[model samples]
Target: MSADVVAGWGGGEAATASGKKTLWWRDAPSARLAALGVVAFLAYLGGTWAFPLLRYYRTPLLDLGKLLDHGVRGGLLYTAAAVVCLACYGLALRIASRSGARLGVILVFALLFSATLFFSYPWGAADLFDYAVIGKVLGQYELNPYVVTGVELAGEPWVDYAPWSDTTSAYGPLWTALAGAVSRLAGKGLLANLLAFKGVALAFHWLDILLIALCLRETRPDRVAAGVLFYAWNPLVLVETLANGHNDNIMLAGMLLAVWLALRGRMLAAMLPLAGAVLTKFWGGLLFPLIIAAGLREQPRSLWRRLAYLAVAALLFGGALALGWAPFWAEGQGAWAGFRLQLFTTSWPLVARLALERWLEPARAMALAQGLALGATAAYALARAVRVRRAELTEASYGLIFFYLAFGCAWFQPWYLIWLVGLAAASWDRERLGRAALFSALGLLSYLLYHFVWFGWGLDHFSIDGFRALAMAATVLPPGALWLARGCMANR
Candidate 1:
């Protein structure tokens, strides 16, 4: 690599085999910062444990009712914790950017932090238990998760703690199957099942880190460690993937693996992981246009080669859908029919329904809004595909995907930002990285308004209360202001 690439703002070399990449505190200030990052994370963990309703209110350490009654104090404490977490994230990124952190050192830090956070409270989300319930329903009862939900498994002692008990699996089939496999191995203990699921999440988290490093190695070899650290040490990623145990990380790992393979000139092989990503989460399939564009951009491209690539990609994706989802496809229209429930239950549709209730009927308004979002996303994808080339494929793809996800989607959760973070990390777009980090940090304020009922928050029910509006503003303002400022600067 050229010196400009090697000296990418950081004095440290990228993954040197000599005396440079040592773990000693003196040689590696990044390592010391990594240790400090862990300390900050531990503090965040402790604060989450103290928060009410995030964990079971009846935990031996905390009384949920008592904590909730002190609403103002509780909210303040939670906000304080969030602020601390964001602050630490900023520090870690600053250190990583300047120190030219080694990938090995960062991985060591990521593993240590993730392992400890695994034991921490789920922290404002109950998705982990919900995953376990789906697993138990599928693995133990042999029921189709696409058709049945945690409500059907209410008889199980652990089901009481899971959220969205009334809804069927919101994810794609591969995730449910993998959850079942893990559940079966977990035996009957509720704690054991939860731990097993968390372990699976942590493993996927590590896999994503590794794939990101590999992708950056291909795209920005000199800044591989910085890119990896950018995603791996992200507070939102750690909390959402490991603590809450969301399966989005697994889907992301598959997606990044496909990108890495594609960058290495293995476009055909890339389809396999892309298929796995799609089957893991349907969002993965949305990336197909970008992949196709990258393939078409290859040198010596001809009609036949393009056709062959299209045919193989289609076959792989279709086969994955047929194989992974066939069993749970339901009667008639298959799993596709069941997915409609997901749309109606999601945040955006609900918001649209509420916003348009006075002017239009709820159902029609939701349909219109959903149609518009999908149409716009499709149009954007086509435009990107028509102009995309290998030289800027990653950057262009990330932009389109982030646009659709950030503006087109109805619900904007913190973990959703992980997709953009992973892509931005490899794309070597510092501005995009800054925006994503800011959004993720601020998006977390959504939890401040979470209203846990007799059980937990469900997709079917939500209110556009004042707190919810404040949370929405938190999600929008920072990024919006940054865009406006950039525009003003350009004009000047």
Candidate 2:
């Protein structure tokens, strides 16, 4: 694709005639469209506030409970909320594309949306409860979270809400340590602890936004708003980061900082945050080889500079990894034991096992599938980085990161898409952005399984079997259709 299409500017007329495009907030029609997006965002918040669906079964918020008491109507409100988020996301993209929106205005609106959603009740995912329970295990009981399962904390009051009774911590040491620190600060109060964790997630959320903005402004100054809003105003990013409080954003903050530093020509300094990202979540570690390739992609004619860059990157990243792993090392196991455990045990291997069950044992099938996917994605990424010039290095990295998350990872979660949000911002590819929006809209259906099948919080069990199929279709079909259509278009 040409730069125009990749930068999401082909359909919209270029504004070079005026020396530079007018910022969208300064334009009347685009500003009005942004106002409408704000209204749509408010509608989303209203739906969330009115019908909080994921309230803990043990400690129900009465107002939210009363709202959910309406059965199917409450479920409909949750769906409506997802739709509103989708609408706002689409509108923001249009405003940015057509009116040349300013990054500052888009950021202010994003921060506003994030703050509003942050305070709203945690509505759909139950991951936050697990985060709290694990943090409590570490902070209050002083146990090694890596070794102690929530089952060991069976007697603890907070464990009542944590679902992973027999499951060890699946996150990285840095994440666990940070969660423990937050747990200590919040003490034993459940609400206070939840808020504290959310605050940390929110801070990283903003940090991810800032890094994305900086990276794009440095690389593609003209497409700043498109890239920034692609990430900052992404509905999936907002919902997952602010409301769900997933640690994926924390991982991305480190990854983005590393990539942003690299963009600024500070290749050595980039390795520190890259290592931090690895410690935050091992997924970030996968980018190390790619970053090395990009660093070498620069100074292609100068072998010594390339070798020096690689050595420094290796030292900085490796040292940081060793330091971050010190806690796990002290416990007599590799810090990455959690990743190994999750690989063998979790539903992350479901797709692989399901596809190859007849040909191989479940374990073998899963291992083979994951290995192939990850290896192929990594090899492709390395080749791209080796070929691309220094200027295109970041986008190449972002594209590979998006591919790795979409296909390389064992399990797919809605929040996992947040990893792509920053990359999408950097690339500003219309097709990529469209598919992301589609995925965000469809991924919301996962909540239906929560509401209807798992808990039946708002709906009766009248057509429970049918509801499961409906939920599956809602969650999976849009992306499949999108891929199919795109393939056909490419062929034609």
Candidate 3:
């Protein structure tokens, strides 16, 4: 055998020849920083357990604005810590490929990161307010939130001021209904029930975090520790979903869990979470198709059984839509049609409006444009999926992330990009010339600039045009890193 093959097998041979030894630290500055980064990040997340919801109450336990404003404060802290925490996660990953017994080091980082995410509180983003508005309709007026907009629900005590809430979001009504259930349980003059909704989102987010851990464990057991940092510590996730209190985090958490289960040959079990995710946001349903493709990878009774799971999952999704409009389907076609209109439009719904307006008389063109976008993106994804190795789940996941965001009409809120950081981080190969380093630096910088401007956090709107400046960094970093990756891939 060649000398290289012998060296590659050294670790296994050494363990048999000698014995395993514990490693408490990595030698490099990057590894030391990775360890410190994990600590600062955990403390940051753990800090949120004491998050003062009462600060926002106009009265004690009722000042809603202050509570949300505090979330903005947390964002700055996040930008600082995410840089270090994620850096370690990325750099250590490359090192581990050449080392041994570093799983504990990685696991420590992951644990702290996930713990931090668990404690973080979402602020008063428009979507969170929308959840409250819908909850109030069910709680206060004894009416269906699906039938009314936030404007109509404005007279209620729980509903907050957000112009966007007047419209139905493409997010299905089941999540709203679930929020309504929380309102019913809380029976509040305070925003306690709205908080109950956040608690539920938090639980699901953590559950999803575990799901990600388990998935990484399956394909890359040693790297599971690093995987934790990527998925858990990401700032886009922190500010957008947790601090901003958006439902997409929980929705995605559910989707990722389902993806994990399906990949592990538990298609039947994956169905419920996938359905829950879809009910939370229409986008969650994308996994059903993804699962179908994944199932096609192997053929047998097990794979055929997935076909049954997919059928049941689809029926469940349609049933969720029906729950919102069962009787209304026959009596209120106009309202139902309006509800259907929401299925396609998002944050920048203007493009969808124009494309369908007067062109195909609204309805037909709307369906066509939406279908075309979906179909085109799906084609890109399936094509990319062709490269997925049995071992590299991260690459497959990141491909989905890029496809989902890039193709959608400009309707994205910044938080929509959070999930990509984890997938990308997991996929990083240090041999690929600091690809993880580039991603860690740029993904975070863009997220920081984007959120600060969007929130007016110590800066006015377009105050510094910071995002544009940050974009310059993203542009330069990738092409520059490409050569490094090329050299590594070629040399390897």
Candidate 4:
């Protein structure tokens, strides 16, 4: 590679003052940073190979069952690998910021990390099997996944693996259709279907990286490499989107594309992808008013022309939503299944509900928690919408998502962190980026808490409330304490 390209690969200047071109590898800081990237990649690869979830599947290459027969030990090993990878990520980011890394190096690492993790089983979640069952319901069985529970296809090989076989699909219609297409393409093999969904996630993961880079180039050119590294090297993002094969990456791709399109002044064109995002996952809908307001602000000042522009944008957004939902609506028979997912609370919200149950009836306590979450989210959204500017759109979106994930989300998972990290990548706000990184790292511990401590170690046998208390402490305290400390420091 040329010196320019090599320089972009985390290397410093390649030419000496005497007009002599030095080898790129000769630069100490760049070589060290690049080495850190490699370490991070290897750590992730090791974690994937050692993942306890692989024990469920039989593979000749590695007898994962034998290796991970002990749940506690296996969980510890996997957690250690994750911690090492996260540490490397932090060091790499710090070094890259000071030494000036480039996109070429970041992209190389992203591809390597993704490819390695792609082969590893999604140890943190069984959501992939659920996707396969849903896909089969739509593709092979010719049934609407949202309307039909996987239990109806219990005899199918894929259905045997899904944990939620009795429940209808909670995914949006757009995702259901895509999953169905992948399932049809993969045919009757269960593994084939799993890999096919993962493949789609992999494609969108790359798209997310590219779109983030493109959006940053427009809004924060100076921070492009840092932004890419923030999202690309995040362990939570890599594991969740690639290994676990969650559809959130696809949702994020749509959101990022919409942001990019808007940044390019194609206000009307932006609505399509934004709509696709909402159809993929309802969280994307939160950005609608903010995006629409920003778009409207960019229109011609003439009253008639602005009104016409508004009408066209609405029609375009509504039309896209209608098209995506039409095939699976089934006269709204089971169309609301996806929204019902929010009724099942977890994380901090669950803790809140349990505490409230001491005073109120169980149902009422849950309702109060859910209602407060909704109200808080709505208040924040309205306050943000009034002040959000075109330039502040990405940061605004990040704040909104962060708010919902922190408070409003009734069912939060580690994979949901992808939404925050994805948008934060395009933003120049270091504090938000730091918060995203912190959450991504801590989020992985949820798996440890849920899998190893609660279930694996049989802590649930003692007291479920105790386990919830532990979860609340583990997931919420660190960030909460940090935010408090930062505020106190700022006051001084």
Which structure among the candidates has the greatest lDDT?
4
Better of 1 and 2 by lDDT: 1
Which pairs of residues collide in model 4?
none
**How close is every model to the real structure, measured as TM-score?**
0.85, 0.82, 0.66, 0.89
Candidate no. 2 TM-score: 0.82
Name the lDDT value of residue 427 in candidate 2: 57
Show model 1 residue runs off by greater than 4 Å.
Answer: 1-23, 31-35, 48-70, 299-301, 332-355, 451-470, 480-492
What is the per-residue lDDT of model 2 for residues 147-226, given as tens digits with 9 covering 90 to 100? 78777865677666666645667777888888888898899988888788889888988887677767776777667667
Model 3, position 190: C-alpha lDDT score: 49
**Number of the top TM-score candidate:** 4
What would the per-residue lDDT of candidate 1 be over residues 1-492, giving only the tens digit for each residue? 232433243443443344234333444555667676777767655755554233552342223323455365666666676788778767777766775554555666777668767776665467777887888888888888888877766566766677566678877888989889988899877778878888898888888877877787777776776787788778778878876677788888878888888888877777788888888777776678877778777846588877887888778767877898778887643554435633532234345555776799766776777777778778888988888766565677577767666556665566777787777777877787888788777656556555332114332253544334445555655675685577599999
Q: How many residue pairs clash in each candidate?
A: 1, 1, 13, 0
Task: List, residue by residue over 1-492, the lDDT tens digit for candidate 4.
Answer: 233332243443454446675554565545666798888887877766655334544332222223465388877876787788889888888866566555566778889999888877766666888888888898888998877888876566555567777787777778989888988999988777877888999999999988888898888776777778888988889989887788899889989898889888888999999999988887888888778888878877899988998899999999999999888777665546435634643456677787898999988887887888778888989888888778788988888888788767777777888999999988768788788888888897677776666667767774665576567577755665665577699999
Per-residue lDDT tens digits of candidate 3, residues 309-408?
5676567655655665452233342564455544532222334444466567766766666666667667766775565543444456665655555444
